[model samples]
Target: MAEESGGEKTEQPTPKKLQDAAKKGQIARSKDLGTAVVLIASAASLLIFGKMLAIAVLNIGQRLMRLDQKDIFEPNSMFTAWGDAGRELAAPLSGIFLLILVASFVGNTLLGGFNFSWEAAGPKASKMNPMQGFKRMFGLQALVELIKSILKVAVVVGVAYLLLKLFFMDIMALSLMSEPNNIESALYFLGWLFLGLCASVSIIAVVDAPYQLWNHTKQLKMSLQEIKDEHKNSEGSPETKGRIRRTQMQMSMKRMMQQVPTADVIVTNPTHYAVALKYDQGKFRAPVVVAKGVDEVAMHIRKIANEHKIPVLESPALARSIYYTTKLDHPIPEQLFAAVAQILAYVYQLKMYRKGKGSRPKSLAKDLPIPEDVRH
Candidate 1:
């Protein structure tokens, strides 16, 4: 249905989709791979530790066989003997089983890392529905499982048949051999058989692992509409983004207005542009534009400067240069330093004159040294 509405699932699953699926325990897994690894590990443990295990078992057997007629007659003695035999076998057996356990964990980790999810384990309505169950019973996965089972049975039976045929005389000779030698020979035969069986299962694992990975990727492939929906959900719609941008601009304008009253002077294009400059000898080596804007915002900055009694100067080239080249709360360029310094000097003089502390200062030059490169 998604394919019909949104085109084919041509794109690979995105990282978010893969992560979400893993959180739901939908990671790819190959049971055959894990089973083959455990079986091989078990075979290796048996081959390496067979002598130790044999010695342990032999000790228990000898202890049992050395029992007196009277000892067998007593139930308490029989229980004591069984307890001693269990203690003898425990160490070697535990080592072998622990190796196989570690192998099982490592095999599963090979593909999917380690992921567990209660959501995947929990009961679902689809799982309980009769129609769903019927479909699952005859699904492609079920058919594949059935074929694998048949292949495994065939392979094991064929190998067992060949091994028995090749070793028939040797097996018949086992009955005539002495006890220790017989046990050793039997272990040798069993180890070879176990290794052969593990090899057979490994073939199946090799085929199944790649198939499972490809099937997992196929299952998670997204249609165009799903990709579009995920994008929209994560990033928001165009209209919502536009509204957010407008709100941010309004808030920024308000903040810029708040900084206007703190400015040392306002340079204006007289109608179109206004740039508020501030300088402190201890804080900055050069003048910084505290606020800047055009048209209505320029008008607002001039009105705020008037209310605060901050100096307002009109120098269209200097204003245009600062407005175009400098960002708010950042130092003006080196090219504009001379022009800014002259304006600041004039402002200081104008302040002293207003307080009746000095003679009226000469007016600032009309042609401020605004470099052509910075004259926007």
Candidate 2:
């Protein structure tokens, strides 16, 4: 006898498995989270170091061109220095910029699954169906976008105003001095202000980016009813389900009777029911249900048990209880504990008697009492 045994082998990953992965730190954030982190970092780096980087380039290019001391400060020479510096810095700076951009794009794509669908970019037929179009026109998503745009404008304007005020403070301090080293002092203050603005703007980007990403993902969750409808559509109707269940039961019965040769005993209703129990000292703490059957299945169970030289006993109540409650490879329930204990004791006594050791059973045998509520 053989069952369709494939169901046990194809294990499904349950929700608990996902939770365990998270608990073990095996989970990772989506690509959006990585993109947001990189963007905020880049914005900060540019804001703070832009002036310092420009000054460094200007100094290097002036030395390389060997500009005269007087010509260095002249308007024509200053414009030439700027153009030369930009040209000289282009290779290293452009390479760095391209690297950062590529890294950010790759990191974000990995964190977030590839969301390359064009339909997600704008309104579509399915999304516009009936009342959905009205909802989309005045939805929370639209409101959030409006707020984000307003906040971005406000932040940029405020940072610019603060930078101007800082510039004035540096200028006023310079005026109080007898001989102001104009270019050096101006560049130093500009560098400081640039760094400050960059730091502040980045703080804003860091907070806003993740919030926007989270809200976007939340809109993609499927509804419960949608899951149920998919399951029914993929499987079949109720009648087809019942037929599959009955076929599975028949296959299970065939496999169960095949294990009877390995059983130690069969407790039975003599005709209508059978339950085969197997036990070994240290192998099991109690008897295990190796097989069970009713009607035609019972006849097969009993026939196999007889052929295998295993003991078969008529115990209608125990057989029925085992059939209803104990599955193959499971222990009998607590309510049937006493009855099973008596059967085990009797079998052990018969083995001792056959060995010609004293026919007397263990004193603990008195402790085993059959339950009164057991029905025949």
Candidate 3:
């Protein structure tokens, strides 16, 4: 017969993985929409806020003229006036800018888990293939741009229509309010308009950025085969894992047998399994398995019990139960309570007999006896 040979396998990307990649900004960012929206918002805010500030400055100047009883319109004072206006507006503008920055950060994080990092922003190798370049130029990324454009247009038109309906009357009545007291009213209307516009624009900017980001991530979901391949790549082949597990079990068995000499008793399946247990008064109310093993290791455990003169008893059920349920230097579980109680009773009887106090108690005789195999 001829020997068979294995062939190499190739790994492929899954739809889910591709979708996730898209979400991570592997697809292009809708920079045009994002930039235009930010610029429009910043301009609108500055214009609306600047108008309100100008009205406040005028009102303040009128009050100052009444108090000082002088022409406060001197050229030298004009520079001071501009400085005062700027200083008065500084705090509000600073607060507004801070809010904008925070909103931008939150929007980005929600969309793609993206945070500003210098490394990712840096330049790297360029793709050399013409087909790859064409794909990059007009692929899913182009679709993202088209969607962003449509969304931006819809939002802008909606906001404009609402603003016209709500604030057109306010704009017309601005000059009709002439009293100095009405100055406050005029400024209040402007503030309301500014807030309404900001609230509207911010809603679009925040929503679309994250929505696109989420869509991108959805595109990167991994298929089952991709997940398996990734596992193999990261954890090595399954055969290697099995070998590692077997090696670990062997090491554990060696360590388990090494602790057998300290055991007070060795419970056994004669030649197949061994579980060595120990107890110290006032320390352990229940006995602890000091060592346990099977096959060659089981034989080594029995040999250690013999050398240490620890009594070994053949109880197939007890031996198998302890081996399967308990681990080295750990207490046996509750289900084997009666079986373990019998083993300990036998051990105690053997100790008493060796001390020459008396014969084995009737209770101990009825239970399994400790092995004559070990002296201690």
The model with the greater TM-score, 1 or 2, is 1
TM-score computed on alpha carbons, candidate 1: 0.84
Error of 3 at 300 (Å): 2.2
Model 2 alpha-carbon drift over 4 Å, by segment: 1-43, 67-229, 234-244, 333-338, 341-368, 372-376
Least accurate 10 contiguous residues by lDDT in model 2: 1-10
Query: For this target, which candidate reaches the highest TM-score against the unseen true structure?
Result: 1
For model 3, residues 204-240, the per-residue Cα lDDT tens digits are 5565665665654454544455577766876889899
Over 4 Å off, model 1? 1-11, 60-91, 166-185
lDDT, residue 375, candidate 2: 41
- Compute the lDDT of residue 30 as modeled in candidate 3: 36
lDDT, candidates in the order shown = 0.90, 0.65, 0.65
- In the order shown, the candidates' Cα RMSDs to the true structure are 3.7, 12.4, 7.8
For 230-312, candidate 1 gives per-residue lDDT tens digits of 88978999999999999999999999999999899999999899999999889999888889999999999999999999999
Q: Candidate 2 deviates by what RMSD?
A: 12.4
Q: Which candidate, 1 or 2, has the higher lDDT?
A: 1
Winner on TM-score (1 vs 3)? 1
In candidate 3, stretches whose alpha carbon ends up further than 4 angstroms from where it belongs are 1-55, 59-83, 113-119, 127-225, 234-236, 315-328, 332-376
